[model samples]
Target: MQDSNLFDDSQLIFRVLVNDRLEYSLWPTVAGLPAGWAESFGPASYEACASWLERHWQHLRPSGLLAKGGGRG
Candidate 1:
């Protein structure tokens, strides 16, 4: 039998990644972290990561953008 790919397996563990702009994303633990992004939470289930992000990342705008006078004229 072929082994399941960790990236493709929702049941596998995941992590919540945050970039310098404070953007959050769900990343599979098997994948290498991209440049300018770091793990903020998890090594937990996908649902858990999603829940954490939902609770923490309430703002959709990047922090830098918000700092620039709410990115408005």
Candidate 2:
């Protein structure tokens, strides 16, 4: 069953995705996931997901990219 309240700002649900390049993204669970990406953590409120991101995604560039000389600075 779909709950309309879940779509509201306060209870918006989201998921975490990481690409081959190791980039972090917040995906809407309702939209589903895209190809070549997998879920890391999810089905949580947006704020909760954001907090997780803050704790984990310290670097913007992927480990592979940085090793390949693709750093921002």
Candidate 3:
């Protein structure tokens, strides 16, 4: 994907958003990210989000998992 068109409105833009539970989800840039979620990596394509999740979501469990603590803990 060309960097110039990454933000173009025609393509499906994706944002790697995380919720309070620290669960990660692929959010469409066309929609507003849910209230409590924050952008981890953003304004990318579906492939980008998928690739990122594959690389970084080593532990599928939410970070808020009591066994793991929360917020990057």
The per-model lDDT (C-alpha) reads 0.87, 0.80, 0.76
- Sort every candidate by TM-score, greatest first: 1, 2, 3
User: Candidate 1 residues 1-73, lDDT tens each?
Assistant: 9997766678878999999898888999888998999999989998888899888887888899888867643
Clashes (N, CA, C under 3 Å) per candidate: 0, 0, 0
Give the candidate number with the greatest lDDT.
1
Least well predicted 10-residue stretch by lDDT in candidate 3 = 2-11
Scored by TM-score, the top model is: 1
The C-alpha local distance difference test score for the whole of candidate 3 amounts to 0.76
The TM-score of predicted model 1 comes to: 0.80
Off by over 4 Å in 1: 1-8, 71-73
Steric clash pairs (candidate 2)? none
lDDT per residue for candidate 2 within 1-73, as digits (tens), equals 8556433554568988888888888877887689989998887888888889999888887789788887695
Q: Please provide, for model 3 over 1-73, each residue's C-alpha lDDT reduced to its tens digit, 9 standing for 90 to 100.
A: 6565433443688999888776888878878777999999877888888799889878766755756564343
TM-score for each of the candidates? 0.80, 0.76, 0.69
Query: What's the candidate order when arranged by decreasing lDDT?
Result: 1, 2, 3
